[model samples]
Target: MPAAALKNKPLPTQSTAKRSVLFDSPYAPMAKHRLPAGRPREWYVTHNRRLKAMRLAIALLDSGVYLANQAHDETIRSTAEEIGVHPPSNTTCHMVRALMRYSR
Candidate 1:
Protein backbone atom coordinates (compact mmCIF):
# COMPACT_ATOMS: atom_id res chain seq x y z
CA MET A 1 0.00 0.00 0.00
CA PRO A 2 1.18 3.49 -0.80
CA ALA A 3 1.56 6.16 1.92
CA ALA A 4 -1.32 8.23 0.54
CA ALA A 5 -3.74 5.32 0.65
CA LEU A 6 -2.83 4.53 4.25
CA LYS A 7 -3.50 8.13 5.27
CA ASN A 8 -6.87 8.18 3.44
CA LYS A 9 -8.21 5.15 5.30
CA PRO A 10 -11.57 5.69 6.98
CA LEU A 11 -11.54 6.51 10.68
CA PRO A 12 -13.85 4.93 13.25
CA THR A 13 -16.99 6.92 14.00
CA GLN A 14 -18.01 8.12 17.44
CA SER A 15 -21.62 7.83 18.81
CA THR A 16 -21.72 11.20 20.57
CA ALA A 17 -22.21 14.49 18.75
CA LYS A 18 -18.93 16.32 18.34
CA ARG A 19 -19.98 19.83 19.30
CA SER A 20 -18.17 22.74 20.90
CA VAL A 21 -19.69 25.55 22.94
CA LEU A 22 -17.34 27.98 21.18
CA PHE A 23 -18.95 27.20 17.85
CA ASP A 24 -22.48 27.55 19.26
CA SER A 25 -21.86 30.92 20.90
CA PRO A 26 -22.50 34.35 19.32
CA TYR A 27 -18.73 34.84 19.23
CA ALA A 28 -18.44 32.17 16.59
CA PRO A 29 -18.88 34.73 13.78
CA MET A 30 -15.94 36.70 15.08
CA ALA A 31 -13.69 33.65 15.41
CA LYS A 32 -11.70 34.77 12.40
CA HIS A 33 -9.61 36.70 14.91
CA ARG A 34 -8.35 33.38 16.21
CA LEU A 35 -7.08 32.23 12.85
CA PRO A 36 -3.41 32.78 12.13
CA ALA A 37 -2.13 34.25 8.88
CA GLY A 38 -0.75 31.67 6.48
CA ARG A 39 2.70 33.22 6.58
CA PRO A 40 5.60 32.24 8.80
CA ARG A 41 6.17 34.64 11.64
CA GLU A 42 9.72 35.85 12.36
CA TRP A 43 9.68 34.19 15.76
CA TYR A 44 8.58 30.91 14.18
CA VAL A 45 11.63 30.78 11.93
CA THR A 46 14.00 31.67 14.79
CA HIS A 47 12.37 29.18 17.13
CA ASN A 48 12.41 26.42 14.50
CA ARG A 49 16.13 26.88 13.84
CA ARG A 50 16.86 26.91 17.56
CA LEU A 51 14.89 23.71 18.02
CA LYS A 52 16.82 22.04 15.19
CA ALA A 53 20.13 23.04 16.74
CA MET A 54 19.06 21.76 20.13
CA ARG A 55 18.04 18.42 18.61
CA LEU A 56 21.35 18.10 16.81
CA ALA A 57 23.22 18.97 19.99
CA ILE A 58 21.30 16.33 21.92
CA ALA A 59 22.10 13.72 19.27
CA LEU A 60 25.80 14.57 19.43
CA LEU A 61 25.71 14.45 23.21
CA ASP A 62 23.98 11.05 23.14
CA SER A 63 26.65 9.65 20.78
CA GLY A 64 29.35 10.32 23.39
CA VAL A 65 31.62 12.46 21.28
CA TYR A 66 33.44 15.72 21.87
CA LEU A 67 31.61 18.56 20.18
CA ALA A 68 34.91 20.06 19.05
CA ASN A 69 35.52 17.05 16.79
CA GLN A 70 32.24 17.53 14.99
CA ALA A 71 32.29 19.82 11.96
CA HIS A 72 29.32 21.85 13.14
CA ASP A 73 29.95 21.90 16.87
CA GLU A 74 31.37 25.41 16.94
CA THR A 75 28.59 26.70 14.77
CA ILE A 76 26.02 25.05 16.99
CA ARG A 77 27.51 26.48 20.15
CA SER A 78 27.90 29.95 18.71
CA THR A 79 24.38 30.01 17.36
CA ALA A 80 22.97 28.58 20.57
CA GLU A 81 24.81 31.05 22.75
CA GLU A 82 23.78 33.95 20.54
CA ILE A 83 20.12 32.99 20.25
CA GLY A 84 19.62 31.61 23.72
CA VAL A 85 18.27 34.13 26.22
CA HIS A 86 19.43 32.16 29.26
CA PRO A 87 22.22 29.75 30.08
CA PRO A 88 21.60 26.05 29.67
CA SER A 89 20.23 24.03 32.56
CA ASN A 90 22.34 21.62 34.65
CA THR A 91 21.05 18.69 32.62
CA THR A 92 22.22 20.30 29.38
CA CYS A 93 25.67 21.03 30.83
CA HIS A 94 25.95 17.41 31.98
CA MET A 95 25.09 16.18 28.49
CA VAL A 96 27.80 18.41 27.00
CA ARG A 97 30.32 17.02 29.50
CA ALA A 98 29.41 13.46 28.47
CA LEU A 99 29.92 14.37 24.83
CA MET A 100 33.30 15.86 25.65
CA ARG A 101 34.45 12.65 27.35
CA TYR A 102 33.30 10.56 24.45
CA SER A 103 35.16 12.67 21.94
CA ARG A 104 38.37 12.29 23.94
Candidate 2:
Protein backbone atom coordinates (compact mmCIF):
# COMPACT_ATOMS: atom_id res chain seq x y z
CA MET A 1 0.00 0.00 0.00
CA PRO A 2 3.00 2.31 0.15
CA ALA A 3 3.22 4.99 -2.57
CA ALA A 4 6.51 3.81 -3.99
CA ALA A 5 5.31 0.17 -4.08
CA LEU A 6 2.17 1.16 -6.02
CA LYS A 7 4.01 3.41 -8.44
CA ASN A 8 4.48 0.67 -11.05
CA LYS A 9 0.83 -0.44 -11.00
CA PRO A 10 -1.55 0.85 -13.65
CA LEU A 11 -4.99 2.12 -12.73
CA PRO A 12 -7.96 -0.10 -13.51
CA THR A 13 -10.00 1.01 -16.49
CA GLN A 14 -13.20 -0.16 -18.21
CA SER A 15 -11.27 -2.07 -20.86
CA THR A 16 -9.10 -3.79 -18.25
CA ALA A 17 -11.82 -5.00 -15.92
CA LYS A 18 -14.99 -7.03 -16.01
CA ARG A 19 -18.13 -5.07 -15.29
CA SER A 20 -21.16 -6.28 -13.35
CA VAL A 21 -23.39 -8.87 -15.04
CA LEU A 22 -26.45 -6.67 -14.55
CA PHE A 23 -24.96 -4.04 -16.86
CA ASP A 24 -24.05 -6.60 -19.55
CA SER A 25 -27.50 -8.14 -19.68
CA PRO A 26 -29.78 -7.12 -22.54
CA TYR A 27 -32.98 -7.77 -20.58
CA ALA A 28 -32.11 -5.62 -17.60
CA PRO A 29 -34.93 -3.39 -16.47
CA MET A 30 -34.12 0.26 -17.10
CA ALA A 31 -35.40 2.95 -14.81
CA LYS A 32 -37.61 5.61 -16.35
CA HIS A 33 -38.81 8.68 -14.50
CA ARG A 34 -41.89 10.59 -15.67
CA LEU A 35 -41.99 14.35 -15.59
CA PRO A 36 -44.11 16.12 -13.01
CA ALA A 37 -47.66 16.94 -14.11
CA GLY A 38 -49.61 20.23 -14.36
CA ARG A 39 -47.20 22.22 -16.52
CA PRO A 40 -48.59 24.04 -19.58
CA ARG A 41 -48.00 22.62 -23.08
CA GLU A 42 -45.90 25.63 -24.04
CA TRP A 43 -43.71 25.07 -20.99
CA TYR A 44 -42.90 21.55 -22.16
CA VAL A 45 -42.23 22.76 -25.69
CA THR A 46 -39.88 25.50 -24.53
CA HIS A 47 -38.16 23.13 -22.13
CA ASN A 48 -37.42 20.65 -24.90
CA ARG A 49 -36.28 23.51 -27.12
CA ARG A 50 -33.85 24.64 -24.44
CA LEU A 51 -32.46 21.14 -24.07
CA LYS A 52 -32.00 20.84 -27.82
CA ALA A 53 -30.34 24.24 -28.01
CA MET A 54 -27.97 23.37 -25.22
CA ARG A 55 -27.00 20.18 -27.03
CA LEU A 56 -26.39 22.07 -30.27
CA ALA A 57 -24.36 24.72 -28.48
CA ILE A 58 -22.13 22.14 -26.88
CA ALA A 59 -21.69 20.41 -30.22
CA LEU A 60 -20.65 23.68 -31.83
CA LEU A 61 -18.09 24.29 -29.10
CA ASP A 62 -16.72 20.81 -29.59
CA SER A 63 -16.43 21.43 -33.31
CA GLY A 64 -14.39 24.64 -32.68
CA VAL A 65 -17.12 27.26 -33.08
CA TYR A 66 -16.59 29.24 -29.87
CA LEU A 67 -18.00 32.69 -30.57
CA ALA A 68 -21.72 33.35 -30.63
CA ASN A 69 -21.38 35.31 -33.83
CA GLN A 70 -19.49 32.45 -35.44
CA ALA A 71 -22.36 30.14 -34.60
CA HIS A 72 -24.93 31.55 -37.03
CA ASP A 73 -28.43 30.11 -37.35
CA GLU A 74 -27.40 28.16 -40.44
CA THR A 75 -24.36 26.77 -38.65
CA ILE A 76 -26.45 25.67 -35.69
CA ARG A 77 -29.03 24.06 -37.90
CA SER A 78 -26.37 22.24 -39.91
CA THR A 79 -24.73 20.97 -36.74
CA ALA A 80 -28.09 19.64 -35.61
CA GLU A 81 -28.50 17.85 -38.92
CA GLU A 82 -25.02 16.39 -38.66
CA ILE A 83 -25.78 15.12 -35.19
CA GLY A 84 -28.96 13.36 -36.41
CA VAL A 85 -31.34 15.88 -34.84
CA HIS A 86 -33.94 17.94 -36.62
CA PRO A 87 -32.91 21.39 -37.83
CA PRO A 88 -33.48 23.99 -35.12
CA SER A 89 -35.93 26.84 -35.56
CA ASN A 90 -34.82 30.48 -35.52
CA THR A 91 -35.70 30.83 -31.81
CA THR A 92 -33.71 27.74 -30.88
CA CYS A 93 -30.77 28.92 -32.95
CA HIS A 94 -30.87 32.27 -31.09
CA MET A 95 -30.95 30.41 -27.81
CA VAL A 96 -27.93 28.35 -28.86
CA ARG A 97 -25.99 31.50 -29.68
CA ALA A 98 -27.03 33.10 -26.42
CA LEU A 99 -25.89 30.04 -24.52
CA MET A 100 -22.50 30.17 -26.24
CA ARG A 101 -22.19 33.89 -25.48
CA TYR A 102 -23.01 33.58 -21.79
CA SER A 103 -20.86 30.47 -21.41
CA ARG A 104 -17.76 32.55 -22.07
Candidate 3:
Protein backbone atom coordinates (compact mmCIF):
# COMPACT_ATOMS: atom_id res chain seq x y z
CA MET A 1 0.00 0.00 0.00
CA PRO A 2 2.95 2.30 0.51
CA ALA A 3 4.61 4.29 -2.32
CA ALA A 4 7.79 2.23 -1.94
CA ALA A 5 5.88 -1.06 -2.39
CA LEU A 6 4.09 0.30 -5.44
CA LYS A 7 7.36 1.38 -7.02
CA ASN A 8 8.82 -2.14 -6.52
CA LYS A 9 5.91 -3.90 -8.21
CA PRO A 10 6.61 -5.16 -11.71
CA LEU A 11 4.33 -4.17 -14.59
CA PRO A 12 1.70 -6.78 -15.50
CA THR A 13 2.63 -8.99 -18.46
CA GLN A 14 0.27 -9.80 -21.38
CA SER A 15 -0.26 -13.32 -20.00
CA THR A 16 -1.42 -11.94 -16.69
CA ALA A 17 -3.80 -9.37 -18.18
CA LYS A 18 -7.30 -9.91 -19.53
CA ARG A 19 -7.84 -9.21 -23.21
CA SER A 20 -11.06 -7.91 -24.79
CA VAL A 21 -12.46 -9.15 -28.10
CA LEU A 22 -13.21 -5.56 -29.06
CA PHE A 23 -9.53 -4.68 -28.73
CA ASP A 24 -8.55 -7.60 -31.00
CA SER A 25 -11.19 -6.77 -33.59
CA PRO A 26 -12.64 -3.29 -33.37
CA TYR A 27 -15.24 -4.03 -36.05
CA ALA A 28 -16.51 -7.21 -34.41
CA PRO A 29 -20.28 -7.48 -33.96
CA MET A 30 -21.39 -6.31 -30.54
CA ALA A 31 -23.76 -8.24 -28.32
CA LYS A 32 -27.35 -7.02 -28.18
CA HIS A 33 -28.59 -5.54 -24.92
CA ARG A 34 -32.08 -6.20 -23.59
CA LEU A 35 -34.18 -3.15 -22.81
CA PRO A 36 -35.66 -2.81 -19.35
CA ALA A 37 -39.30 -3.83 -18.97
CA GLY A 38 -42.22 -1.78 -17.54
CA ARG A 39 -41.62 1.35 -19.57
CA PRO A 40 -44.56 3.01 -21.37
CA ARG A 41 -45.26 1.97 -24.97
CA GLU A 42 -44.55 5.50 -26.18
CA TRP A 43 -41.08 5.30 -24.68
CA TYR A 44 -40.20 2.27 -26.76
CA VAL A 45 -41.66 3.85 -29.88
CA THR A 46 -39.61 7.01 -29.49
CA HIS A 47 -36.49 5.06 -28.63
CA ASN A 48 -36.73 2.92 -31.76
CA ARG A 49 -37.53 5.98 -33.88
CA ARG A 50 -34.42 7.74 -32.63
CA LEU A 51 -32.24 4.73 -33.36
CA LYS A 52 -33.64 4.40 -36.89
CA ALA A 53 -33.12 8.10 -37.53
CA MET A 54 -29.56 7.94 -36.33
CA ARG A 55 -28.76 4.99 -38.58
CA LEU A 56 -30.32 6.70 -41.59
CA ALA A 57 -28.44 9.91 -40.85
CA ILE A 58 -25.12 8.09 -40.64
CA ALA A 59 -25.82 6.20 -43.85
CA LEU A 60 -26.68 9.41 -45.64
CA LEU A 61 -23.51 11.03 -44.42
CA ASP A 62 -21.43 8.08 -45.57
CA SER A 63 -23.13 8.22 -48.97
CA GLY A 64 -22.21 11.92 -49.37
CA VAL A 65 -25.66 13.37 -48.63
CA TYR A 66 -24.65 16.27 -46.41
CA LEU A 67 -27.54 18.72 -46.29
CA ALA A 68 -30.92 18.06 -44.72
CA ASN A 69 -32.69 19.26 -47.89
CA GLN A 70 -30.64 16.85 -49.90
CA ALA A 71 -31.92 13.97 -47.76
CA HIS A 72 -35.47 13.39 -48.93
CA ASP A 73 -37.80 10.97 -47.16
CA GLU A 74 -37.51 8.53 -50.07
CA THR A 75 -33.73 8.77 -49.97
CA ILE A 76 -33.61 8.04 -46.24
CA ARG A 77 -36.04 5.14 -46.61
CA SER A 78 -33.99 3.71 -49.47
CA THR A 79 -30.83 3.98 -47.39
CA ALA A 80 -32.60 2.17 -44.58
CA GLU A 81 -33.53 -0.63 -46.98
CA GLU A 82 -29.98 -0.80 -48.28
CA ILE A 83 -28.74 -1.16 -44.71
CA GLY A 84 -31.25 -4.00 -44.14
CA VAL A 85 -33.56 -2.05 -41.87
CA HIS A 86 -37.30 -1.66 -42.44
CA PRO A 87 -38.51 1.52 -44.07
CA PRO A 88 -38.85 4.28 -41.50
CA SER A 89 -42.02 6.32 -40.93
CA ASN A 90 -42.38 9.95 -41.98
CA THR A 91 -41.64 11.14 -38.46
CA THR A 92 -38.43 9.14 -38.37
CA CYS A 93 -37.44 10.62 -41.70
CA HIS A 94 -37.99 14.09 -40.26
CA MET A 95 -35.84 13.21 -37.28
CA VAL A 96 -33.09 12.01 -39.61
CA ARG A 97 -33.12 15.33 -41.45
CA ALA A 98 -33.07 17.18 -38.16
CA LEU A 99 -30.05 15.20 -37.09
CA MET A 100 -28.28 16.09 -40.31
CA ARG A 101 -29.24 19.75 -39.93
CA TYR A 102 -28.03 20.00 -36.34
CA SER A 103 -24.86 18.05 -37.02
CA ARG A 104 -23.67 20.93 -39.15
The most accurate candidate by TM-score is 3
Model 1 lDDT at residue 92: 45
- Model 1, backbone clash pairs (residues 3+ apart or across chains), number: 1
Show the lowest summed lDDT stretch of 10 residues, model 2. Answer: 16-25
Candidate 2 deviant stretches above 4 angstroms? 1-33
Quality of model 2 by C-alpha lDDT:
0.69
Cα lDDT tens digits for candidate 1, 1-104: 88875664333233121211111111111122332557568766555445444543543444333354442434334323433323444444444444454545
Superposed on all Cα atoms, the candidates' RMSDs to the truth, in angstroms, are 19.7, 11.9, 14.6
CA RMSD (A), model 3: 14.6
Order of the predicted models by lDDT, top scorer first: 3, 2, 1
Model 3 alpha-carbon drift over 4 Å, by segment: 1-31
The best candidate by lDDT is 3
lDDT of 3 by residue, 46-67 (tens): 9978977887797778767889
Error of 2 at 6 (Å): 34
lDDT of each: 0.39, 0.69, 0.70
lDDT of 3 at 93: 89
lDDT of 2 at 86: 79
